[model samples]
Target: MPLTRVALLKGKSRAYRKAILDGVYKAMREAFDVPEGDLFMLIDEYKPSNFLYGETYLGIERDDDLVIIQITANNTRTTEKKKALYAKIVELLGEDPGIKPENIFINLVEVQKENWSFGNGIAQYG
Candidate 1:
């Protein structure tokens, strides 16, 4: 399972935000083979003053539409799959919310399966 966090500057419409969440989940399912009903995600809206970023970092030329995505998941994917996941996410989001690929920033944090405890104080994947 992947716990996804999407961060963006505030004031976007509800549909836009939901589209982002949906696009991310769809990308994970397609690229990572995530099971149905395994969705877990959240969005963080930041004020413009607090959501600071380099507008032209690495010459990508990001703007106010920049989206920051971070996902924490088990370290069970190959490098190729990881690359596919990023590409798929950008493709999906670009299609839906019309987010520019250059504005999408993704970070994946991998961990051992034993690191999670879904409930009842037990590591379900341990």
Candidate 2:
């Protein structure tokens, strides 16, 4: 099982967000051989002022886009899958939203089965 978490700065249309998520899931499923049912995706939206680039917030008056994706997996396959997914995301967003690839950051975390719970007090896959 794998979990992908995404966080983005505000101002993007719902359609844009959907496209990115769809691309990510597709890439993950194909690259990592993850079952669709085991894929968990979460998106968090935040205001531009909430995210900083340097000494200033992302976008002041204009639209500023920043995306962060975190992937949690149990092995090396997870890492490769996340790398592919992140590349796909960057490509999609760059083509459609005109966002620079440099603005996106991706992180991968490997953890033991005991670290997560799906529901009903039951642990997920080991």
Alpha carbon lDDT of each predicted model: 0.96, 0.71
**lDDT (tens digit, per residue) of candidate 1 on 27-105:** 9999998999899999999999999999988889999999999999999999999999999999999999999999999
| Backbone collisions counted per model | 0, 0
Q: For candidate 2, list the clashing residue pairs, or say none.
A: none
* Model 2 spans > 4 angstroms off: 54-63, 76-82, 92-99
Question: Candidate 2 clash total?
Answer: 0
Give me the candidate number with maximum TM-score: 1
User: Using Cα atoms with residue i matched to residue i, what is each candidate's TM-score against the true structure?
Assistant: 0.98, 0.73
Model 1 TM-score, 2 decimals: 0.98
Worst 10 residues of 1 by lDDT: 52-61
Candidate achieving the largest lDDT: 1
What is the alpha-carbon lDDT for the whole of candidate 2?
Answer: 0.71
Q: What TM-score does model 2 achieve against the real structure?
A: 0.73
